[model samples]
Every structure is written in C-alpha cells, then in structure tokens.
Target chain A: MIKGGFAGRILHVNLSEQRTWTEPVDDALARDYVGGLGICIKLASDLIPRGVEPLSPESVFVLGVGPLVGTDLPSSSRMYAVARLPASGTVGWCGAGGYTFGAQLKYAGYDHIIVSGMADKPVYINIEDARVDIRDAGAMWGLGIDDTCESVYRDLDAQAGVIAIGQAGENKSAIAMAFVDRISTLGRGGFGAVMGAKNLKAIVVQGSGGITVSDRKRFNKLSRSLLNSFREYKYLKEWQELGMLKAFPMVPIDVYKRMKERRTACVSCPVGCKEVVRIPDGPFAGLVKHTSSALNLFTPMMYGMQDPWEAVKLITDLDSYGMDMFEFFGLMGMARELAGSGVISLTPEEPEIDLTSFSSMSAWAERIARRQGTGDLLADGFSAVLEKLGNEAKQHAPALIKGIHPYAGPGAALPWDRFGTMELGQVLDPRGPHVGSGGSPTYFAIRPLEVFPKHLKRMGIPENVVDRILGPDRNKLHVGRLLRYSHAWFAMLGSLGICARGQVNRFYNADLCAKAYEAATGIPTSTDDLRKRVDRVWTTFRELNIREGLDASKEALPDQWFRESGFKEYLTGEPLSKKQAEEMKKEYFDEWGWEG
Target chain B: MKYEITYIQENCSGCLRCQLACSRAYARSFQPSAACIKIESRGAEYRIIFTKDCVECGFCADNCLFGALTKTPKEVTA
Candidate 1:
C-alpha cells in the first residue's frame, strides 16, 4: 500500500540541457496549496525570472497531476500545467482531464513535472517510469492539435498519452490552448501560446504501478459513502445534465435560435447543453465543431450565413493559435464598433461600446483571426487591442473588468438558468468580478442563499460570510474574508485532488471533504484547513498579480458594468456607482491587509 | 449480479467521476484512459459518450444520478 496519499516526488526536466531529475513533493506545500496552485507558486518563486521575457529561453512550464488523481475519488482526473502566462503577464495555467500523466507520475514515483530552459530545437518529452527521452518533434510541427497528438501517440513506442498544441501555438498566438487527448484542453489564459513560444510540441507519458492507500478497508468504507453522496446531490445531476455548454442562448437571439441543436459538454459533465448543429454542411461542411457560451456568437453567425462550417473554422482556428478566445473575440466586437466612429479612446468608460458595424459576424471573425485591417488590433487581447485602435478606441472598449473581459452577460439577459454569477464570485472584486477564484455573485440567486449559508456556518466561517461578500450596507467590505475561505476550498480540492464540479463536495459538502481527507491522507484535516490551503494558493496568485501590475486602482470594477447591468435594488434603479465601487475596493484592500 | 454503467453523451459534463471511480475500483490508480469506464468527450460541443466494456456494473449507475448513465432497463447481469 502507498500509505497516506501521495506519490511524493516531482520530476524536473531541463529541456535546454536535455536532462531529468527528481524533487520531493513537499508535504507542507501540499497542505498549503496542492498540485495545480502549488506548481505555479513554487515555480514562480523557484524557476521563473521576473523579466526574462516569457517567449525567451528563461520561461518555464510546470505540469502537475494532483495526488487524489487516478484514484477512486469522484472526478479527480484533471491535471494542471502552469507557466508564466504570456497574455495575462502573470501565472499561466492550463489543466486537462485524464489518468495518463497522473498515473505515470505515481508509477514513476513523482507528483509533478517541471520543464525549464527551452531546447535548442523543437522536441517532445517521452516519459515512463524509469525511462525518459527528449525526441525531435520536427516532423510533428505545424500540424493541427488533433493530428499532432494522433501522430505522436501513434509513434511513441509505448502505451502513451500526449499533450500537444497546434499551428496556432507555433504562430505564438497568446489565445492558443494546450490540447490533451485531442479534445479536452487547458483552454484559458494562453498557456498554449507560452508552449508555442517555447518551441516545444508535446509531452507523452506512460507508466506502471498504482498508488495504494494507507488502509484499504477504511478507504473503501469512506469512498462508498462519498460515491453515494455524489449520486444523491441535485447539483451533481445538474452539472451532469448541463455542463459548460449552457452558454448558448446568449448569442444574438436572432442568430442563435434558428440553428440550435441539442447541447453537450466535455468529459463526464452534466451541463451538456453546449449545442451542436449541422447546417447541410457546405462551405462549413463536415465541420463538426462546438463553441463555448462565451463564443456563442459563432452559432448565430453560422445561422445568418447558413454556413456553420465557416464560423467553426474561424474560431477553432483561433483556439488552435492559442488566442485568448473570450477576450480576443470580444475585442473584435468592439473594433467593429470603433471603425464606424473613426474614433478611439485609451479607456472604455465614458462612452458605451457601440458596435453597430459588428453586424456582420463573418467579417468580424475573419479579420480578427487573420489580423487583417481592423482585426490586427484584436490579435492581442482587449487591453492591447484598444491600444492598437488608439485612445479613441479605448473609450469604446469599456466592458473590461480587471482586463478580463466579461465571459457572459448580466443575470436577466443570461443564456442559462444560472448566470454563473454565484459560481463566478466577482460581484464586488475590483478586477471585475470574474477575476475572483470563487466567492461568486450567488448572493443574487434564489434558494442557494439559504443552503450555502448553512453549509458555511457548518464549515465554521463567520455568520456573515455571505452578507459580507454580497451584502448591502458594506460595513466592512469583507472581500478578503470570503476570498480566504473560497481560496481554502479550492486549495483543499486541489490538495485532496478531487473535483468539486461534481458530487463529492455538493452532497457531502464539507462533510464529504473532511472524510475524504481522512480516507486518503489518514490525516484528519477539516473543511477549514482545506479552505485555508485554497486561500494560500489564491493569495499567492493574487500576490503574483500584484507583482505583475495589479494595484488597488486596477482592482476597481469598470463603470460600464453598473451602467450596462444597470444593477438596481429590488425596487430602486439606484446604480452601484463608480464611487461606491471605489469604496468597496478600499474596504477590501484594507481588510486584505494590503498596503494599497 | 453485475450492472453496467453506460455514459450517455447527452448528460455527461466531463467531470470524469466514473473514470476516477473506475481507476480506484478496478485499477487502484486514477487514470481515466486506463479505467474500465471511459469518458468519451467532445469538448467544444461539450458532450461525453461514456462506455464500459464491463458487463453490467451497478457501481457506476448507482452513482450516476444525472441520467447520463443508464442501467439499461433490460440489462441482465450474470
């Protein structure tokens, strides 16, 4: 038996030197941050150079698979990769789902792998317990993500799993994503672009052996209850049914409603509503493609043109090139608006983004992807795109919150039943609500408010956990308190190496978490410990952001949200003004114990 | 008696609980591609087609409340 949960080692692969070494998986680090979060924090402090210029040789890529992964724990199959994000200028992360790497690392007797120092030429890493190699990827270069993974996995002389990027990453598009198992990806924040910049193609893994628990009887006893709890939860059922595809209807209604089909989701998800449609397959023929809710614009445009192929081709190309789809694509909408006024502004606050010319979805995406004419300005992200359009363009691009564009719209106008505000937790953060790791705007939702609070009290958070995060009156903007708690929860999820997206946490909530830990770690860590660990990870990332360019000023939400959302009390139209937002930020900063 | 857990594409969310469970139950490892229960994914479309060659394993169905995994009403285990 493995005993007390852990593979307990991290492998260091120096691509430049073409060597591999082992490092211990620090237990304290595991307790504080777990795999995904820990990899970034540890690598930032250990591997990366503050100003090495991310695309250069100094940048490092660290991929981690959590300890609970590949275990019988619910949804513990996800693995995370971390590097300095080229687009966001901070910690870059891409996580994928599978047992490939997680099992390999365990078999190899390691917890994670960090690849630093770029190779002199393109190469792929092949790993198996007691075996490692740096193989030339010259033949695999320039291929699409799907083809490349197929090629490499087919050629790799072992039972293998491959993680690769496509021509988009090779092109160094910051929006590019890393492709694992050909389908699922670490889709956000341009991790793929960083990989592309590194001139590396893929990492293939295979291993033998399995992690044994301290006590099989106790583990089985706890897991049965955990599984039963998962089967019993309503949220588990909802996620299993809906998945992330829930973001469809938000596309311009006239455009989306026509071509709508049944929605689906990624591996093992419940919210499978992400729609797929076949439009008689013409120019867009055989174009079996799916877009996230944030990219719902494609379906509608596909409908208008009666050509789903063209729309799919355009955005899928964007994803391949490692472009920040949400921010990059949203910028295109803003640019089309700017072209009409022949006006530009550095900041997008005063004048609303009037994207009248964005009427033609075809031209908007094509131009942005190819960086043609107005599209060139959008190749970076919204902040960069606005700069390219000039100060006048800035005024029109006012929808950004902490430079992270709105992934979705307001509650009433939301595409799905739950607008994800409760899950997204940015109702009050200055970086515009989505920047929050947890602490969602669920305070605005119904029913959940009651149950969630009871759970929090059970977890031992202060009675005011909800009211402080989303409460009116704002006695002391308790953003810090909530941030700490949510961060801890996320940390615990990572530490225990479980997936909160499904049943384990929902049915058992804190109860399941405590037991899962005791079952796995043989350590009786409480729910509060999990939350604190998550907070440590979150706070460290927040600090990383602060080091990058975040300050109290940047933390304030944009004026346009209050304007566009026109958020009003149940009876009053009184907007949560910019001044009020500033007050909230200050209070948050003060409570967080930041000097700002 | 045994029951099979067949993952239906329409209801899966890419959560990989089945695989995680399978890895532990059968493999004692957390590898999905290695698990007896597999999650077939369509990321952009957000669909999962879960398949298990195992003959009627009640464990998966017992845990799948989403209707994503069906017990195959007529399915008989031996």
Candidate 2:
C-alpha cells in the first residue's frame, strides 16, 4: 500500500549471534499503533519470553525510529527505544533527537531496529548502509560516554549513530542508560544494565540515501504551516534558546537553587530549554552543561543542599561513570541520614554532617562512582544498603519513590480519593494515565467515574468549572472520542516519524510539519491523517506496555503522591495536595477504558 | 578544514547528536558507533574536546546552543 511517510523496514540485530536482518513493516501496524511505543512493544512481544531475567543474555533490546523525523519539522528528529528494564522489571525506554535519527535510518532503507540476546565478547555493532560489523570495543569499556564515542569514531571509516553506556551500564548496575550523541539519553528503569549484561557495548547505524513519500504537494503545504506556527509560538522561542531543559530551576524549586540560566533544546530542536552552568569553586569547579540533568537532578539537589553547579557536576560525574543519578542521590539520602544520625562518621577528607564544602561534595561524588570506602555502599545501590541498614533505612526507603530517595519530600503530586484507586488503575491496566500532558481527558476517561465528593475533593482547582473536569457523562464523557482523536494524532505522527512534541509541540502548527515531511520526502499528507499517525504511535506504545505488563491494576500515583509532602511548591507556598489527583486518576482511567 | 567547538569535556553530557549527525550526513544511517565527529573527555583537565577529521561542515557550530561549537562563515550552508 502507498504511504505518506515511514521507511517501511524494521532492522533486527542479534548481538549474541552477531547477525542482522531486515523485515518489511506492515502498513496495518503503522495505522494502528504509530511508531515508537506501538512498534517497539509489538516487536518486543514476539521475542520476550515470559519471566526473562532483565540483565541476562536473553533480554531484548529495542529501538524505534518514526517517519516524521528529520524534514526540518520542529522537534521532529527523534527516535524511541524500549525493552525490559534490568533493574525495575518494568518497561524501559528513552527518546532522542538528532539529525541522523529517522532520516539516516530511513536512508538506510529501514524504519526501525531491534537487537536481542547478548554478545559473548566486548563488541560494538556497526550498521552502514547494507554493511554491518561487530567490531571489538575492548578499549572502550570503563570509559565515560564521551570517551567511548571518541574511540569509536577514531576506529570507524564511516560516521554512525552511536548509543553507548558508560561504566555504570557495563557494571549492569540496573540504572544506567544508553547515551545518545553525548547530549541526550534513553535513561529510565535501568535497562542500561541489560545492555551491559549482554556485553554489547554500543550500537551504531548510518545510512545515506533518500526516502520517498506518498505525496509531496500536501506535505509541503503542511510543513510550511507548521514552521510558521513554530516561529510564532512563544514556547518555540524558549525551546530554540533553551532546548528541552526549560524551567530547569523551577523543577527543583522545592529543593535546589543553582540553575544559572535556562537554555535551549537539543540539536535540531528549536525549543531551547537546556541550560549550561559552571561551578564557581569546588572539586567540580569549572564548566558543565546538561539538558534534563541540570533541570531534573542538579536543580533539585542545589536547592536541597544549597549548592547548584556543584550538585549538577556531581550528577554529571555519576553519569560519566554510568551511575544512576536517581540511585546516586537516593543513596546519598541514606548516607546523609546515616551521618546526621551518627551511624557513620566522616572518614578523613570525607564530609561530616556539618560540612558545607562543595569540593568535599565533589570528591564524594567521585568516591561514589569509584566505589571507594563507604561509597561502595552507595554503589551497591539503595535497595541493598537499605536492607543492610535495617530498620532506619527501611523506614526511610518508603519515603523514596519506587525505592528512590525522594527529593521533593513526602507527598508528591497525587490525589487522595483518587490515589490508590486511580494510579492502581494504571498499574492494573498498563497504558498508564496517558499523562505527560499536564492533564488529558483520555486519562479522565480511564479513571473511576467522578463522584461529587471525590470530584470536589480532587478537582481542588479553584478556577476550573467542576463539570468541565468531571465531564458531563458522570462516567463516559467523550473519553472515547478524545482517545480516538489522540489515536489519529499519534498515528499520523508515527507514520511520519514526528516525535518532537516536548520541545516544540507548542510552537509548530500542523501545516509546517506536513510541509517539512513533504519537502524532504515528497510525501503528501493532511492534518487529519497526520493526527491518526500520532495516535497510532501512542496506542502502539500503550499496547506494548500492556503486553509487557501494562494494565489497569498496575498504574497508580506513587503512595507519596497522596500524602502531603513536607515541602511546598517552590514559587508558590501553597501546598500541593493529592486529593485532586486521586479523584482525577479514576475519571482518567474510566475514560480510557481502564476498570479496576 | 577544522571545526571549532565550545564543548568542555564535562559539558559533553555524552548525548552524541553531533556524532549521529556527522555519521548520517557523511555516511547516512543514524549510527554514532562510527561517526567522524568524536568527543574525547579529559578527566584531569575537566574537558570534552570534540575531535574529528574536519569535514568543515557548520552543522555542529550552527546547532550549538552554548557557543560550544562556533561555526566559521565558510562552513555555513546557504
């Protein structure tokens, strides 16, 4: 069948066997699930043996590139990867933006790639056009992501898309990530450990050619429209200047303060949200730049510890060593608690509970990465050390999110009436609340029907009309309609490979996207069809997660969400209450066809 | 041809978009395992220097947000 976008082939690389193959993608799959989430899940489902060990050789490593990538569409050059998490036993994946992403992959005559099993020796997989190589990465191991990429480039004749892990993944520590282009990452749920478990050092692919689209005229028109909208949108300016790390300081307002400035999105992203900062004086004193890392970890830690750049550098160092930033900090919480309570005393140059020296903190970060002295306890991870510390650690562990040390304090952003009942719904059914958006009705559709008290309780919104959020159908209120619309949106984008929502979703109008895709590939499409592609992609991911144990019962706001965190929103002293989230979760679940 | 960059090793973040783009523009697939652009980290110096046989394409410089990779006029595409 003719298509507007998509390269139409799926690439499979088997590390254990050191073999690669190409399979034509079915149009039906594209229409239904979209690309990243849908395609990867379905792809993973075929080979995932039930109850497979995450870090074992049998694990599946998956990558997906969509059709809408490249083509100069705002935030469009991105790809998604998913697989069994070596640590959390939950679905794991990350998305990245780069020039090579789908464009290069499509030029190589494939839409996506999935790697399975493990390599017996230290090796890296190289994909160049039709050629493939499993070369040694012996010197690359133990090196940071930066070093690894440099070494790979030195040895290769052609340029390649590189996804590699630092020492943390090599250790299979269960929280490492596949670093992309040294600026973005596929981090979450600890599958970097799975890659390490496979002894597969990295995967690189490069293709040079062209992809043909179904129609060109329509594509051009749409892309132009999107570009113009992007130019006019306020957020696009922010993205172009900052990238994806916008509001870096705001994220940690509840804890940290050293976010020097907000910056722009990643390469090819017009929305510049990432920021760069330099530690004024400390062991890590100097320069450091991060997109999400600066915002997510550095910002929070700075506020909590009253040190910004130092905190960011500490995490960056951990990232270099491939340590899970979450784990690093979570373990620190334990360490800090231990020290403050006198469970452990400062070991020489070590920090005592009273130390404010950032250099000591910087040294402490290195020590943790090197697994020196008590740092080894942290390197062992929170789950183990908490167990070793027994009661106090265990008591504090719940304060952590999913065994992670919570930074924003007890009570995160959840609702009470909706808490157990709501998130429990996402847990029970796998697709989650379909969040990421501040709030989407699809989430409302899937959650428990809004009862008056619960609705009033959770909807704590002072301004929102109760009925608007509660929806007219005490139970059904157009969730299916919204979902269908969402499906179309994802399907359209998936088919086009346009996953740049985070940085420029607010900036680009649909028409510009259409024009870019068309201009690049000569494919012609419409806004309506484009939406279908987006929906298709989202559904595919949702379904994939479902197949991978995403169900209504398994989803819920973390327990801490319902309880009030001791801290309040940084800018607003107004306390965040979970009562509304709990109520919303049920309404969200029901709207999405989730029943618990 | 040479490429200039503001990338301090610690700032690399190890995302590899530069490598991916270099590989794809010159070679065509999104594989950075073999890109011409390389970022080398000097631990003691606290820097990540981008190294590559210069194609002199202004992609990195044009795309740099932090002035990490400053592009010369000759490298910019029309």
Candidate 3:
C-alpha cells in the first residue's frame, strides 16, 4: 500500500441518478497505473463501453491528479481529463495547469473524480471537502466561462477552484473547450461538448484538507534544493519578465512591454510563465485578458491580424465562447476556401468570410458558438462538414488526422522544415495534434545529433533501446524509435503531475523524478522501475486507443508535407519521401510491439 | 536579535509556494489554509497576510523566489 501523497479515495458522481459514492484507491491499481493520466486511462478504458458515443450518457469522464500534486513540488499543479472526445471519437487525455484545481481536488479527499450519466437539467458539482452536491446551475447555463466562474465564486468562495464551459460547449460545438479558473484551458478535443451533453455547467471545489508526504524531511530538502537552483539560475529574472516571449519572440517587445501587467505561476511553481495583459491604448483600451502563455497572444498574427489590440479582442471573444482557437481557425480557413471555389455557399444571413476583418471573424465566432444558420454545420468540425459537402469540398480541406487539424508540419500553422518528436507525435498520438513535446530533444528547436545520446540517457532510455534508436551506424537517429521513449518520458511526467513544458522539465531528469516520487509516496522506486512503470502506462494508453480502432492504418503524415519542398529529416537533413515516412511509422509500431 | 518577515505584496506572483512551505513545516502537510502565510487574490493582484500562529521561522520567506517575502533582523529601538 502507498504510504502518502494520494488522497486515498476516488469520488464517483452519476448525474443521471444524482448520486455520489467514494471508493478507496486500490493499492494494486495505484502501483501499476501510477496517477494523473495513467490512472485516468485505466479507469476510462475499463468503464467506458466499447463503441460508446462520445456524447452519450454512457460515456465516462475522469479527472485525475497525481500523487505529487498538492505537495510543495514545483509545477505540480497539472490535472488530466480523460474522456471519449467528440472531436476525434477516441478516448483521449487533455491536461491543464494552474493553481487550486488539481491541488484542491486532492485536498478535497479525491485523487480522481469519475463523472458519468447525463442530468435532466443544467447542474454543477459543488465539492466542499467531504460534502459533494449536485447544485442547480440553471442561471449559469448560457453564461460564458468567465461569468460562470464568477457566479460560482460569488455563491461559494473566490478561492474555490472552478471548471466551467461557455456557450460553445452548451451548444455542443465540436471545437468547444472548458476553462480552469477561466485561465488554463482543460480540454482540446471537444471534451466540453461531452460535459454539455451531460448538462454539467461547472465544478466548484473548496478543499480544506491538506496533502501529506510520507518522507517530509526528504521531500522538503529536495524542494529546497530545486528552488535554490532556480534562485541561482541566470535567466530567472528575464524569464519571469518575458515568459515564453523570450524564447519564441512571437510578440513584439514594444507591444509586450506596453501591455504586460504581470506574470502568474501555477501552484508551487517559481517560473511564472502565464501572463496577464491589459490593453494600454487602443480601440479596446483597458481590456484585460489572462492567457496561459504569451504564445497564445500571438495566435492572431498568423491570420494577418496585425494590431495587437484587435488580436487580443478577437482572442477574448473566442475564449469567452469557449472555442478551440486552433480548430476554429482551421475550420474557418477551409470554409472560406470552399466558398471561394463554389463547393459551398454562405447564406445571405451568414457573415462574410473575411480573415483580416475583426468584426467579420468575431461574428463568425458568435454564430459558431451559438450554432446559428451556417454555423450549425461548421460547428460539427471538418470531417462532418466535409462529409456533408461531398468529395469536391473534401479536396480543399487541410491536412488532418483523426478528423482534427494538424497544428504543425509543412503548409500548417507552425510550418517546419524537419521532422521532430512532436511532428511524429501529432500523427501517432490518438488525441490528434497537440503541443505536448514529452521533453524530446527535437521539440521546437534543432539540436546537434552528437548530444542526442546524453539527452536520451537523461530520459532514462535503456542502453539497448538507445542503441536501437541510434541504429547500427551509431550515428543516425531514428525519430520513430526515439518517439517511443519520449512517450514513456511524457507518461512519467504526466503521471507525476509535473509540468512537461521545456522550461520546467529541463530542471528534471528521470533519476530526480524517481527520487521525488519515492520521497513523496515512500514507495521505493529506482530509475529503471519508474521507467518500466511509465512504459506500461504508455502502452496501456496505446492499447486503449487500439481498442477504439486507432492503429497503424489510422496514422498518416499530411500528404501536403511531402508535396511541399524543403522539408527534411531532423538528423540526416535529407529530403523527406513518402516511403521514408511509412518506414518511420513502421519503426514506431514495431518499437511498441504492435507490428503485424 | 529578533527576526521578522518582510512582505512585498507586489512582488508575489501568487504561486503559493510560501504557504505550502509554511504549512508543510508547521502542520506536517501541504495545505494553504493551514499555513501561517496567506495569499489573497484580488483580481490580478495579491495580498499576503500572516496569521498569529506564525513563529517567524522564515520557511515561507526562504521559499519565496519573487522577493515577496524575506526574513530580516528586527529594527533596534532607542
């Protein structure tokens, strides 16, 4: 049995029956699955019925926190939401980080909350320590995420953790998302639609209990050492000031200097990566928006919106509607193309498809969120929309996997010339395109091939596996083989509720993570043991997806990626070919022991 | 010489590490409400408050990386 860290219980809530029950976390389950997305996958795989409609009452939604959460560990504020997502029709996990939500849920005496069944009317879950109530949320039903959270805070406490969906979710839009504390986004693949189908408006939690560690002395000492390292780091000040803008430089320095109000960090985190910005002087003067990172603020620049104030306003409107910005843009881009080519026609009542005009885009966002007129068809996402418009329209659709848009690769949003772990991950991951790099060396930057062995070793890749990844020449790096280890590393971080962002994960290695886990839970763990456990977790995740009918056949790089010139391999820098891409997928499937 | 915690509310990024450290040191668990230090959120700003049970152990101050808290010797009196 585990000695500490976990809250030691799981809370099951059935909205249809308005019933709640507590189940003791099984020791065997905890030992095998670990926590966070690990346990989430296990529970989802077992409970969600085969071929269950993602929006049906039978679909299960699991929110899980790892043992390290609610502790003094830096950036241990992440939580995972596992559900059969409507966007992809696959059971997927989406993680978000902030203060209160994960930690408070744990302190409220639950490591996981498994929500099932649909309510007859609009309702919200109120969790106050041991008191769990399904309260009426009729008044909050049509409200935006910001207003819903405010209403909950007003009725309860301002410090209460809240996860709420907006109008887009209520309308069951395929691109809908939910927000944590109205800042960090919870779901990406239309998990909000699932919540809407269940009539769950929000979840407010006020936890008074505390989280205890088995070895306090060791945990405290390790925390202190980690904090001291940050204090002495040369870039702490600059990082705190610029956040992600320092690395990406997506936003202009002048605009950032003028608008940035302050930086915020997740629970126990010293690196304040989140930004709170206010419009300094513009048409939307005095407007304030809290973004997960500075990277979000630059999203409009990709669509030709140059004015920062206008961009912020557009982003605010979309966020208020609870829409996935990436999906919305991708769908709108396709819609415009289809209309221009005579494959589809926009009704007179519908707004014009103008990417540059803020008013036009804002109108589209509102219509889509409310599912009005043409928005009804657009709200169902690319695959559904294309299926209605026939093959001619499908030809104009952008490269997509699992019925969702790919955010990176050639001719995509963040175009890159070379394949990396994330590039491969976008194709391989069942959840579709995401930014979870899993601490890969090829995440966002090009690195020297000679240093890959050290990076691989740091991720706890076994020597034999490293040899396999490096191949016979001991020089060429097989991205697919390395992706398997990256997935394992990602599982380890996600299971522990640690931030997998490059800035934070760089401070951690597999050895340190094992020590931290052992110290937190008093469960004896070695680097190899931790690696093996995480590998199991990743394998289970893949197996669950396989059960959902996702296999090597479903995996495909965008055809446009190869058609476009200049794209090359990360290690060899050689031109990419369709045959080479297939080989990568084969290598990945072989490494996972899923070869035919 | 007596030491006291000097708090600068503006410097706090609201990570709540101070509260976690204080609670862990005193209550043997990680609970923000149980901590001597409290970070109250006022919109985008933060207000730090210390409860009467605080022994001025400096754990919160030591753990704060944003210069929000610091332990210093008390001012000498005439």
TM-score per candidate for chain A alone: 0.79, 0.76, 0.97
For residues A199-273, what per-residue lDDT tens digits would candidate 3 score against the true structure?
Answer: 999998888899998888888888788878888889889888899988788877888889988888888889878
Deviating ranges (above 4 Å) for candidate 3 = A471-474, A572-574, B75-78
Global lDDT for candidate 1? 0.54
lDDT of 3 at A375: 86
Backbone clash total, candidate 3: 0
- What is the DockQ (computed on Cα atoms) for candidate 1? 0.32
- Which scores higher on DockQ, 1 or 2? 1
True-vs-predicted CA distance for residue A354, candidate 3, Å: 1.9
What DockQ does each listed candidate score?
Answer: 0.32, 0.08, 0.80
Residue A593 error, candidate 1, Å:
3.9
Q: In terms of TM-score, how similar is model 3 to the real structure?
A: 0.97
Worst 10 residues of 1 chain A by lDDT: A411-420
User: Candidate 2's residue-wise lDDT over B20-55, tens digit each?
Assistant: 456545554433444556644332122333454656
- Candidate 3 pairs with clashing backbones: none
- Write model 2 residue lDDT over A466-555, tens digit each, in one string: 345335544333322232233333334434455534344434344544455444443344544544445445555555566556543344
